[model samples]
Target chain A: MHDDLYLALRQCIIDGDPEQAIELCQRALAAGIAALDAINEGLVPGLNHVGEQFAQGEMFLPDLVMAGEAMKAATAILEPAMQKAGARRETLGKVVLGTVQGDIHEIGKTLVGTMLSASGFEVHDLGVDVPFETFAVKARELNADVVGVSALLTTTMTGQKNVVEALERHGLRPRVKIVVGGAPVTRSWGEEIGADGYGEDALAAVALAKTLLGK
Target chain B: MQPKLEILERELIERILGEAFTLIAEPGVKVQAPAAVELLAGAGARIEEGVAHIPEALARRALASAPREFFLHNRAGEAVVRYGGDAVQFDPGSSCVHILDPATLEHRMTQAADLVRLVQVAEMLPQYAAQSTAVVCNDVPKETGDLYRLFLVLLHSSKPIVTGAFAAHSVPVMIELLAADSGGREALRRKPRAVFDVCPSPPLHWSEFAGQNLADLARAGVPAEVVSVPLAGAAAPVTLAGTLVQHAAECISGIVIHQLAQPGAPVVWGGAPAIFDMRSGITAMGAVETAMLNVACAQVGKHLGLPTHGYLTGSDAKVMDAQAGMESGVAALMGALGGINMISGAGMLDSLACHSAEKLVLDAETIAMAQRVLQGIRPRGESLALAMFAQAGLRGEFLKLAETRKLFRSEQHLPSSVIDRGSLHAWEQSGAKDTFARARERVAELLAAYRRPALAAEVEGELKAIVGEQARRAGMEQLPGLGT
Candidate 1:
């Protein structure tokens, strides 16, 4: 019965049915299944499958977005139960992401955020045109393992460098790795700016984040 | 000429229109402007909670009142662009915040110099029928960015402009500036030099600013192009057909309000519709499905016998690579074959986030090729070159024939120097440049050849004064120099 529940939850997420995903979580909990077991065996695998499909180009943005919604619904129900039982939900890492200051481009950063979350990282999206200090402050507050900076223009690449400087100044550079990506951002620029890593696109971002965490 | 393409059947178009008419009355459209609501309410529309229920007869009547075609005149007082029929004109994409610098091949915040260069390039290129206020100069204050771009375009080029007003209040000043350029308000009306693009928020919502612009542009006798964007899957519906229904409904509502403002002010059925790529959560402008949406929606507009416009010749690729070429090439061809009157989105890249002058010139080549295809087998004199073929006698070399020399220029589209049709040895001698490198060279050459179209000194001073006055009102004391 637990195995069937897991399959149902995974299928619900793949189908992008958030309400069904939450109800299945509740039903699994009512049936005396452990919350962490439900998350690891069901929600995580569901997100992983969705991510794989997205990478393989079998699924598009709306499907992935729906899957994200479903995963959130399942997590919302299971997370509280896990806390009550004194168990913690496993995360790959925590990341704070934003488009750098003076660059109002949001799609690239938003894509990276969604892909990271689907790959098991907890993400705090600070949104577009985020100032440098905000990145460090948010990273320190969240105790994030990674902070991804995005700049779509060459002019705004300075904002990414400023973010790295702020992270070092806050004494959080050692704990939090910095990853940068945008249209104009290159691997050489990443090295020049003292970034921990670089992503050519959103899929590469997920891989870079994993390598940064040594996962 | 190439054969025209149609994505929607006549019956299906009728059904879509019928559904849109019903949609306007049923759930209805939300109008945020009290003045627009009053206009619709006065025009026999039922209003409740800011939503106006327009009747089918009222919509039909409005459509009938709007002129089927109108012309935008150039500075020389020549009607250079017609907004109806099978006229296919290209314009560089508008309002991009960043420019893809050809020299460094990097994106940067657009400057006033960038806008000026863009206009100069478009002014020189025969491919673009009109020049657009292509980019927002970030060097200037944001409040006056839109009108400021237009000001620079007017200052730099003699071509009629495709532009928009960013603020509702800036509309009258912009009109005044155009009038000053054209000698006066009455003369500007008689030969309007610019068409303002007005937009409505998708899913049947028109903002107060949008309504005000539409009403003001209508009352001023300036042409207004309604750009209604509906993102299929995310904003409208997952299906393209459902999105088309929403597109028609939005456009119909826009026209209802526009015609209500004035009985017969010109408004084009224009939109930028794209499929919501579910995986990336992007409105994929480069996708074939997105191009189909534009074609199909324009078909609905054409069936209603209105002037139509669409966003095409755009790409989602971040770089000027193969993906950009393929996506933009296909979109441009489809839009051309689709017969959209005023096709925008040329020179646009990264899903319209960035503009490149190199890409603009290259896309013009693509448009030239599309125009050749549109010419579709002109046999001339009711015969298939019978006399020339008879003289050549099948498979005979026509290269030396006098007929070939005389007719070749007309029959074939001989591309400009930008396109490389040379021997490999010649290419190697010419710096071993790829198309991008060659395009960069061409851009420099064009800029070297560019001369700012002459304007009366008094008129030029007046245009500058108006822009400066508006910048001051917006809390910016000085207008940023165009850096010409």
Candidate 2:
């Protein structure tokens, strides 16, 4: 019976069903379920399954968007109770995610965010077209474990290094774990920009973040 | 559709083919790598002093046995396309990232969910033919990218898939996937729709993995595509002619290997060759040199009577702006005119590294326009305006004539939104939007309109069980969401 609920929740997310997902999540929360219990038991497994199916080509974008919203909704509900219980989720680490300045491509960032969240980390998505200042300010404000910046184009790849350079200028370089992603980013590039790590794809990014946090 | 090129104009095509031939005949292409050289030497191709020149006669003999057209079946077990005529085939190319938020430049691992969305989008659009570019996992540890993409495409759509099996070791698993699933072995073997792409690394080489894949694909009765990726200034000589010679040598050598493995099995004359930008040291997909290499080489491939393939239709333009449209549009146009039978790399951006969801929608629009262009002009009977104009009398406006409405839709390739046409009042009423915003809205609408497809209860169970086994083996004790 619970497996059905679990499958439904995942399907709802992959379908991008925020409203229905909210209702389902609310029900689970009302049932006095452990917040971590719900996440570990229901949400994480669900998204991961969707992701696997997605990788297998069984699911796609609507499913991804649906899954993201469902994840967001479930996480929103899970966070309050976990905080009350003094049971902060044992995350792989914290990641500050953002798209670089003058560019609004966020699919890479969102995928990284979803993967990070599923991997058990707190991700502060700074939305799109974020300047280097926004990332530095937020990393400080949120106390990010890693600041991951993504840029899709060759022209905007410079924006990736700009964030790292900004952290340096602000004298916050040592404190932050800087990572770069998107299509144009390579390990060589990450080295060139003095970023701590670089991920060619989402799966690699998770491993990179985990390693940086010493998790 | 445009009238067929006249027999008189066929001479021009012959000239183009002859030009490609002259280069290959003279100053024979340099063959690098022992695997390719040995393979060519084994298959009756002439090789001397490390220079491999596949005689035109041999190319013809190989193509004589090559199948001109084939069909790929969809999920419902229906053949969805007849791969001939002016039909343009699109498939998911090898990509590392699927642009989820193009505006934010955010990407996620192209997971199963992304594959599902891509399949839906590809199905709805007129451009795509095959079901893949599906990467198997976003988080799984073991699966490599090429194999992963293949697995995902297999699961998501019933459409015949277009995939390149990477790293020779994965071939067994891939063959199992194509053969082992719900369908029995004969059903799997008989269908033979997954046309595997085998690349000969430039200046002329096939790694053991690719050589092995060619043998495996052919022995299994599946068709083969001889793919070459010669980056000018890096892989081949910087000249277009030099690249074409290298591309020909690569194909001829590949054909020899493929046919040697299993005689008369199909093979494509395929390449994704491009130029390395001198400024950034990056491979430039948008450069005119890149377009010329693809087009000119395609002519050579056709000259050998082989079904040609090129990984064109991809753009590196960062944003979904004018640059994206112009770059993708011109490249797609050239690819179409060059008589490329299968053009992969749709929905790709940033020089085939990143793929954009929004751009996929926009690129579909551009492909629609290119398809219309290839249609050319029709000089059909009454279709010519002579009779209509005679009836309408002098000074009659064609716009006001009754035949205008009757023939306009047929004559004029009407675009479904993404190309807006509205009077000022109607335009203002409908939200005065440019192409990108309108594209944004279209993407949202398509996404919103999507209904999650229900897999068979049994298939869903199998998929879940497979994932569960992996997670549990990875040492997660309590299954996620199981008790909830």
* Cα lDDT of model 2 by residue, B1-484, tens digit: 4422121134554554454445444554455446556666776667787676666665556556666666555545566644444455666555444455645656544554565566666656656666556433344433344554555555555567777764676666566556644354466556665778887666555566777787777777766778888887656777766666677767766776677667766667788999866433356887767877887777776655667788776776766777778878888778777767778777776776666666778778777777777778776565577887886779887778777777787777777677788788987888888787787777777766654443465654554555455456555443322210
Candidate 2, A47-145: lDDT as tens digits = 777778766767653455557777887778668889998987777777899999856565668877877876678888999789988899888888787
Question: Positional deviation of B81 in candidate 2, in angstroms?
Answer: 3.8
DockQ of each: 0.27, 0.05
- Report the lDDT tens digits of candidate 1 across residue range B369-474: 9888888776765567677777787788788788788888888999877789999999899887777887787788888999988899999999989988878886
lDDT of 1 by residue, A66-177 (tens): 7878888888998889999999877899999999986766667877887888788899999987999999999999999999999975547767989999999999967799
Off by over 4 Å in 2: A1-215, B1-64, B82-86, B98-100, B106-112, B134-137, B142-144, B180-182, B380-383, B394-402, B424-431, B451-484
Q: Largest DockQ belongs to which candidate?
A: 1
Candidate 1 stretches greater than 4 Å from native: A1-4, A19-23, A52-58, A75-215, B389-397, B475-478, B481-484
Going through the candidates in order, what is chain B's TM-score?
0.97, 0.81
lDDT of each: 0.86, 0.68
True contacts kept of each: 0.45, 0.10
Q: What is the TM-score of chain A alone in each candidate?
A: 0.93, 0.85
